[model samples]
Target: MSSPIRLYMSMSLDGYIAGPDDRPGQQLGRAGGRLFNWLDGRKSGGPSGQVYREAPATGTVISGWRTFKLAGRRQGDHHDGVPILVLTHYGDEGGDGDVPPGHARFVTDVEDCARQARAAAGDRPVMVQGAGAVRAVLRAGQIDEMEIHLIPVLLADGRRLFDHLGPDHIELDLVRRLEVRDVTHLRYRVRRPGEAA
Candidate 1:
């Protein structure tokens, strides 16, 4: 039993992960932070706090280069200083200007990145984020489970989480659902091919 690759993210009702024009200065884009308003760090002991704390337990993180920049290049401190594997087309030659040398390892292959992350994670789950990384993992059938913090508002324009999935249908089994504050937390287990329904 290898470590599971899990994706945890907040998305709007319309399936948008971030608002339109989600650039460096703007970060999550216009009013996109609303999706995460429910994650109140002040209430760390509460349910919202539990959700905030869950991310830190991850042993490794996988992200897209664009998302790494959008996140202000925090390295892996977001996951309590865990190793971060960045997926990029430029490979080692790129992302060094902002990410530094040892803070992150740049990899061109999505599957290989995930493999390294899993090995580093050991028994702990590997946290996957960034739209590009998530999409690539999905296309590769590498994701084991997912936790979606579904927001109430709808952002008509922005990056969608389920785009470019091709014609094949990806099935997921609902594991848990919780309505807390202004967001609904949904957990799902990805059903691999030939798996029981």
Candidate 2:
């Protein structure tokens, strides 16, 4: 069988996943989205942005409809190079996401999205992107691993990254915590239902 879904994202010290007022032109900046800089070290040849550049060259990258739309409208069609999956109630308009070098598809359900991604990814990796959308996968227990680039900055009030799904928690172990320049990159493995203590 294929591997479980993997969620990659970052968080702040205050717990605000994104900048609070998420209006157009007033996005994560004022809402404490500075945390993205943690992964900023990954510039063209730098460290922080390397995770994004070296992520196994997957078949597709999945995101929420909002994120996809926002990136599409704001960035003006630049969705990395892999195919993208946007989960939302809105229909796939094709113009809402980046013009991928691979492909792009809009999906509604999580399972169908994963199946399609697995097929497209082949032996490569599938990136479950966007902080808000990743919480859904985590809540559903569909995520198997995580690669979080822990930055130093903090947001006073941004988007909250948690799902508030009962009191249950996903167990994780530190696979690596490397300090790249001024930023820190952390890797973790989600513990299964009945693993070890």
Candidate 3:
């Protein structure tokens, strides 16, 4: 069986992932940097801090075009060695080459991208980043788990995490919750109707 797909992201207390007017240079938008203040001067080797120290053994990463372009333009291969599958209709664009050699590829279809990511992941889980891609996967019922790092900030005018989820209601079961400084980590298992609890 293929590995499951997991979506991970950090959002403000008010549920905004990125601030207003997000651009290439300012992907997180104005005042967005404040959301990551919990990691400043954070020491390693502590029990509560282990989650930050342990690198996720992700086999593949999936991201939306805007996220991929911004990250790749600013810092090449933001996910390090993990391969990334960028979902976009403009696959012929030139920015795709900014990623590490053979580390990233562009795909037009979301389902095909997920399938390829899962195959590439093998035993490990496929990591999906960015709010746009997360919403797409969630609407498709392709995500198995979601880990949200809730920061203690309120970006009232930024892009919401769940803005365009269509008319359907997606259900999630809370699996774990941990508090590290001002940030709260929430792990949820996606559940569909008629599925075993």
TM-score (all chains, Cα) for each model: 0.93, 0.79, 0.87
Q: Output the TM-score of candidate 1.
A: 0.93
> Candidate 2's residue-wise lDDT over 1-197, tens digit each?
57446776767655565677776565564745566665445565655556767665655677876676556432432345556776665555544444422355667777777777777667666778766568766776777778776656666666766647458877898887767655577888889878884
Report lDDT per candidate: 0.84, 0.65, 0.77
Count of residue pairs whose backbone atoms collide, per candidate: 0, 11, 0
On TM-score, the stronger of 1 and 3 is 1
Lowest summed-lDDT stretch of 10 residues in model 2?
72-81
Per-residue alpha-carbon lDDT of candidate 3 for residues 66-169, written as tens digits (9 for 90 to 100): 78777743243544667788777666453454433356777777888889999888898888887888888888788999888798888998878888899977
| Shift of residue 149 alpha carbon in model 3, Å | 0.4
Candidate of highest TM-score: 1
lDDT at position 42, candidate 3: 50
Error of 3 at 55 (Å): 4.2
RMSD of each: 1.8, 3.7, 2.6
